[model samples]
Target: MQTIGLPGTAAPHARKPGLWGWLLLAPMVLWLLLFVVVPTGILAVYSFCQRDDLGRVVFSFTWDNYVRVFDPIYLNILGRSVAYAGLTTIICVAVGYPVGWYIARRPAGLRNLLLLLVMIPFWTSFLIRTYAWIAILKNEGLLNGLLLSAGAITAPLELLYTPVAVVIGLVYAYLPFMILPVYGSAEKVDNALVEAAHDLGAGPVRAFSEVIIPLTLPGIAAGVLLVFVPAIGMFAITDLMGGARVPMIGNVIQNQFFKARNWPFGAALGVVFTLMFVFTYLAVQWHGRRSQR
Candidate 1:
């Protein structure tokens, strides 16, 4: 009779960490301490402290900044940021998955070329690319010109400086991040597993659902986190394509430090944002462990 291991059972062939593993990880640990940990610690301290009119830290303890962050205006802005990021993540996944899959399945000689094509846009500056979008989507821009020439519409569609335009920019900027990770997973997938599923009478949809999806889930999760987290804090695209019409959480935090001169409030927002990323990372790890079981 075969025996099944309990959920919390240790791996039967687990090995202890070696000297090489510790050595390889030393740089990452130092980087986290110097850049991420130190900076976040400073931000947390400032958040619980006060800032004077000249934007100098006063070192006085206070909860006013955190309380103000929960005000209706800021909360609404946070909600909008989450919504925009969510939309961008969804779009990236939808657009990137097929491209990644195609690249992964290509002939070895052509795969590099296809992957290069995916990364070609990064040769140009991101800001420059975003500005190019401005020229294309503006009222009297290329899109309108083309439409007018074709007699498709009489007036300009007002495509630029709108939420839709911001979403477009976000999706364009982050699609590569989503594609690369998924491609990594798809490239490593064994074709025989898929063929075996087919041989066992599994339909195309069933094979994809039961086999491909599970195998590529790690890459999907990685891509989602990469796209969603950064999209939430992107201020440039929102300011440019969104016309600064609406305030997102990113804009609010930026405004606090610049226009409002409220360093404490900005620090508070940063702390909260950092904590959110930590929680999300933990949740993803937990979910992966559960799925493995």
Candidate 2:
């Protein structure tokens, strides 16, 4: 008969952390407490509080801010933000997958070179790069000038300060996030598995659908989270390219603090926004696990 160890008994390999371990972990614990935990606590407290006439957060508790969050006007803005983010995610997946696959299949040296090119844009300031897009998209800008010179069109197109420009800026900014993860996953896929599928009378589409996609799904999931979350909350691109004509959730939150001078309301918006993101990430993780099972 086999005997099981008692629940409270330590296994032979089990050992307690020593002084070195505690010392090493201390910095990380302190960092989290200072930056994450403390700020979240302050935000949570402010969310439940009220603001005075001067727009200062008062300690008096109230649910008015949260109640206002569900108002129709704000709900519409939230819905619009979701729509924009969803569209951006779809575009990123469509454009990035092929780029990732191509880069992953390249010779090792060429692969590194292509990846360097992808990352090269990051060397410059993000604000400066965004401003560059403004230059290109403006009515009398490079795109319009070149088109006119080539006789492609009779007149300049209205490219800047539109929904189209916002989407373009978003895709440009987040494409690298999607590509890097997809490339990482695609790089690890065995060529032999693809060859085996072909041997079994599978066509390119069938093999890719059954084998390649399934294998690279983890990366796809990561890319979706990366691109979707930030895109939803992005204010800079929308403000610069979309001309702030359409207000997103991020813009609304920014307005609460700066324009409206309602810090408590802004804090409430931020708390709710954070919760929504948490819920979304958990849902995605749950779905991924369920699919795997």
Candidate 3:
């Protein structure tokens, strides 16, 4: 009689994807090639070319566009963008982690309701939501009125068109991105393992630190990836809230393409931005693998 493999022994080898599987993947692969790869190729080609006085792409090779990206003014903007994104990521983790954990630990019915509430903001148009923040942060807006009524201050604070307003908009928009991923990870943690740690004389803090955090790390990394990358490149939030006072790299890229009519420089900036995304992804993946090891 043939014996079944034990848990420690290797199981039967799985079959590779066949013709039907390839057929299923064909649409997605084609879509990626058309939308992602082709566009990136075009952008890279443009980045190496020049622009004429008439704002036309000149099919000639030059490294000036990339060199210009390293100019002091642009470098400062890049630094500022990184700083803002880093701050937003930190705030999201601090606030979202607890909320996600709480919701995940709740009763089934309540958990669904809380998740719905967290996701409701996405139902509305992003532009409309950002405009709503302008009304709240303006001098004569809801926030100032509330502060005045509460006798918090005599004069209205200049909250709008500032770094603080920009940060608030960023945090408000991206907090849900952080929360959902964390909730997904936190929900899967086996309660028995936590209990076992406690039974072994681990304190609440110790158990949570040593067990819960590690278990939820993948979600946190995913959340950071989701939040940090887009946050760095977001132009709308910074524009409406910051009123041109705080310009991120996204704003620079947009202006290069539209306002300045400098496609080559814009493409260079875009290529750099894409590289940053790749680096962030690889770093997150590396960290996750290290934690697993």
lDDT (0 to 1) per candidate: 0.90, 0.92, 0.94
lDDT, ranked from best to worst: 3, 2, 1
lDDT of 2 at 255: 90
TM-score of decoy 2:
0.93
Query: Per-residue lDDT for 167-201 in model 1, tens only?
Result: 99999999999999999999988899999999999
Task: Tell me the deviation in Å of residue 6 in model 1.
Answer: 16
**Which ten residues in a row are the worst by lDDT in model 2?**
1-10
How much is the lDDT of residue 239 in candidate 1?
A: 92
| Models ranked on TM-score | 3, 2, 1
Q: Could you estimate the TM-score for every candidate?
A: 0.91, 0.93, 0.95
After TM-score superposition, the amount by which residue 288's alpha carbon in candidate 3 deviates from its true location, in angstroms, is 1.0
- lDDT of model 1 at residue 93? 94
- Structural RMSD, model 1: 3.7
**Candidate 3, 1-293: lDDT as tens digits:** 01334444343435567899889999999999999999999999999999999899999999999999999989999999999999999999999999999999999999999999999999999999999999999999999999999999899999999999999999999999999999999999889989999999999999999989998998899999999999999999999999987779999999999999999999999999999899989989998888776
Kindly list the per-residue Cα lDDT of model 2 for residues 195-260, writing each as its tens digit.
Answer: 999999999999999989888888898999999999999999999999999999999999988999
After superposing all C-alphas onto the true structure, candidate 2 shows an RMSD in angstroms of 4.6
